[model samples]
Target: MSTILTYHYVGDAPADAGSHKSLFVPKHEFESQLRAIKKMGLETVSPEEFHAGLLAKDLKRKVWLTFDDGRLDNYELAFPLLKEAGLKATFFIIADHSLGCEPGYITVPMMKEMLAAGMSIGSHTLTHPHLARIPAEQLAREVAASKQQLEDALGVAVTSFCYPYGNFNAAVQEEVRAAGYLLATATIRDNRNCDADRWQLRRAMVTPGKSRSRFRYMFSSLYHWLHEWKNRKRWKPREEA
Candidate 1:
């Protein structure tokens, strides 16, 4: 099985980040988590390798590192550490945020630099709207236009899509597929076993203030088993008296 981990901001969350400040993972903590992944013998896969692994069902001891929202801190803080660790990650860009109109998010130049350093890019929608609640026309534009914008700007064929805020439904997913994306990731937390759906591929979010031990547990088969069990129990039907 393969694990997909999600991250957002790196280092301290700036005051402008507002309520989303809780998403910040300190640089030290992030570095320790990366080291723990290495210590546990989990190898980070490139986007192409992850896609191929999903198709072949050959993922074992593999992990895919992903960062969402195209934050500049990701470029300033996380990029160096990843390079130093000899690792690669996919940064899901909010296409509109990279157009220089946004203040805190990454720009197209920064993304290109990271890509040149062996990182990958994916689409995170045009405006990061709630995909499940949007109208059909808006949903279609959010999925298809973002891919076109990112690819046009980055000069690469973007094939992966990440649901903004992990909000997606069947219609939203179909729009993504119809847009020609190969895979999509959701907010669900679990390892990608052979039977895992590529459209809703599970990802465990790496939040702030997580301990080294806790981070280690995130990669454990036992943790995944317990997580799955809890989810099943939560949704399971109550027995009749």
Candidate 2:
């Protein structure tokens, strides 16, 4: 079994950011979390590797680190830590939010630097809309167009899709598949076992503040068991493989 962790931002709050700043973690905390994860021997894999591992049932002690929205903090803060740790991760980027258009979003150069450093990139949709609430046509456009845009911009195949707000249904899942995405991730906090669905892969959200012990226990077998037990009834199992 393997756990996939989700992060939004990793930097100090801006003065004007207000309550929206809750999504960020201080740079030190982020580094500490990565160190704790690495100390536990949880290897981080790209989305493609994760998919292959799931199919081969060879994901023991492996974990996938994912960041949502193409934030500059990912390039400035997290990328160096990951490189220093000898780890790789998939960044789910909003194509529209990238480059010089959006303030605080990473530019194309930064993305290229990350790719050169061995990081993978994925699509977080064109505008980051809620996939479940949108119309079918709009949903298809969001899923398909974003992949095309990211591939065009980054000059690499963007095979992963992350559901904005973790809102997706069967139809949304199929839309992602039809969009040519090899994997899709949701905010379900549990280890993805052998029976994991490639399109609806689950992930645990990383809060800003947590002790090293809590971070260590996150990858513990007992913690995963407790998480499964608590969320089992609330989460429907994936379709049989």
lDDT of each: 0.85, 0.83
**Per-residue lDDT of candidate 2, residues 1-241 (tens digit):** 6788888899887888787677788899989888887787788888888888988888987889899998888988999999998888889998888843698888788888899988999889889897888999999998998899778888989999998987788899989988888999887777655544787787777776778877776677887788888777666653221
Error of 1 at 8 (Å): 0.7
Top candidate on lDDT is: 1
RMSD of each: 3.5, 2.9
The residue ranges of model 1 lying beyond 4 angstroms of the native Cα positions read 14-19, 233-241
16, model 2: CA deviation in Å?
6.0
Worst 10 residues of 2 by lDDT: 232-241
Question: If scored against the real structure, what TM-score would every candidate get?
Answer: 0.92, 0.91
* lDDT against true structure, model 2: 0.83
Query: Could you give candidate 1's per-residue lDDT for residues 1-241 as a string of tens digits?
Result: 6889999989987779788877999999999988988888888987678889988887787899999998888999999999999888999999888875599898988888998998999999999999888899999998999999889888988888999877777788889989999889888778654434778778878988898888877778887898788757642332110
